[model samples]
Target: MNVTSGQEWVRGQFPRLDWLPDETLFSLCSRQHLVMGNLDPATTSTAVLGLSEKFIKHDIPCGIAALEQNGFHYWGSAESILLHHTIFSVFVPFQNKIKIEDAIITIKGDRIDSLKYRLGLVSSGFGAEHPLKACPYCMREDVDAHGIAYWHLTHQYPGVLICPRHQAWLMVSTKSRRWSGRFEWSLPTKDCLIQQASSQKLWLRPAFLNLANNVIDLAVIGRVMSLESCTVAATYRKAVLQGGRSASLLDRIEPLRRFHLFESLPEDEKSTESFMNQLIRTPRRSI
Candidate 1:
């Protein structure tokens, strides 16, 4: 941050720093914002809200000052950073969960934006209020080695209830990305995790952790996988039938519903079995 006479290079004030492993755009933005001033995270968020308006391009950095300067490297590539690390990145993967689509690779910018109407993700309804989580042991290790701590993208995924490394339970801070249009710049604290870590033995409960890991794996694959097919549901039905549970998936819907994450839905949507059956009957509606 050099000065020419009394003039300062605004860009150099907050130059893009080397990114951390598995960092997300919001996390990176928050980190950069901290260098600017001691203002509230809400103000920082408002300042960077324009970052979301950007679309990927071959050149011109990421359209955001700090990110564009880095040439969009590290943690994730330029393409994956924009398409998967940002908040908007959730749309494509979530929609793909309905059905795999090869077209996801070539999805038009406008088409992606239009999903705003079909899916109400912007209002913090879909996995937004879900707390920004951190692993306590990881934080301690990072702070001990690097003298700082920050959020990891892996722990932020909704279904990732446990830390893959250390096999410790991840914990959320007091703040969350609420629908109030204000984001909080909360770094991991000592109390960020539960006092007792029940997930420390995840390896022993192979079945439970394996299922969660599978979902996380799909989350990673969904990023690069084409959006042209749907196999998860069919495979689930096959497994049920093979186990002599029931030929019709409906027969086991009650058991499946117990594990499904429907807490984010409205009370009316609490009926997972009914919704699953509806999607089955009118499969085209899913598209």
Candidate 2:
């Protein structure tokens, strides 16, 4: 029940604001909060969080419920954008190797929803610290077209450091809170840009740029959830073979030279080895 002006205590039902295309659930929820008039983001979020089931960690459960009520399709918002899109795409080598459908089931299954276990919660390698990224061009374009800037579905994914359309490096906003605590949904603005990026090395490689775009394609347009892990691994092997960057050959290459041969990219341009150290473990099934 949203306490804002006694706006009907409809359990499991949420009010729908005019949601922006590719808007994050966080951003949409934030907008909903603001519409209640004069409510600060924190207070508004707390109000919405009150509607969710106890086990739901992030605001996603209620956020999805609200969006679902509003007639937005379920898969793109919840599974593709808000959930494990980052790890499934860029962070994992050979995206084709992932059993995306099974992975989706595992994440959204009753086991997780029931609060029975926290199996994939900490994607330490992929989810460590991707700064809140936005392309300035995309923001300006949104303001021009939609009249309000909102987080893009593509921009929110962790490994995506470039805007697929703009081809410019996405600027990292210096937000008030870190990733875990950042429930304050914000749209990109000129004010949010880090002035240091112009002088600093924040750019991404073309290969990575293409890969990020491909990941988004897989996420939004393609039906990749049906892929099997063996198929995924096989695809990876093919790429490696075609690349001719066998492990034995890679050993003789220099550090910078070896990078191209390896399918893995550092989580960010400035990522340290220790930060990207964790392995993508194989899924365990119940007996």
Q: Largest lDDT belongs to which candidate?
A: 1
State in Å the error of residue 72, model 1.
7.6
Query: Which candidate leads in TM-score?
Result: 1
The sequence of per-residue lDDT tens digits that candidate 2 reaches over residues 1-287 is 34953444442254556557766555665566655553455555445433333323322233433334334444355555434322334322323333444444544432334211222323323343345567888888888997777666577565466688887767766662254354454556778666324533533357557656766765553434334445554665565567544343333222323232222534332342222122222323320
Scored against the true structure, residue 265 in model 1 reaches a CA lDDT of: 33
Task: Give lDDT for model 1.
Answer: 0.49
Q: Candidate 2, overall lDDT?
A: 0.48
Clash statistics: count for each candidate: 8, 3
| Residue 187 CA displacement from its true place in model 2, Å | 2.4
List per-prediction Cα lDDT, in the order shown. 0.49, 0.48
Candidate 2's C-alpha runs over 4 A off are 1-6, 9-16, 46-63, 66-124, 176-183, 195-205, 221-226, 247-287
Model 2: lowest-lDDT 10 consecutive positions: 272-281
Model 1 misplacement above 4 A: 1-8, 46-78, 83-117, 120-128, 177-182, 191-208, 226-233, 246-282
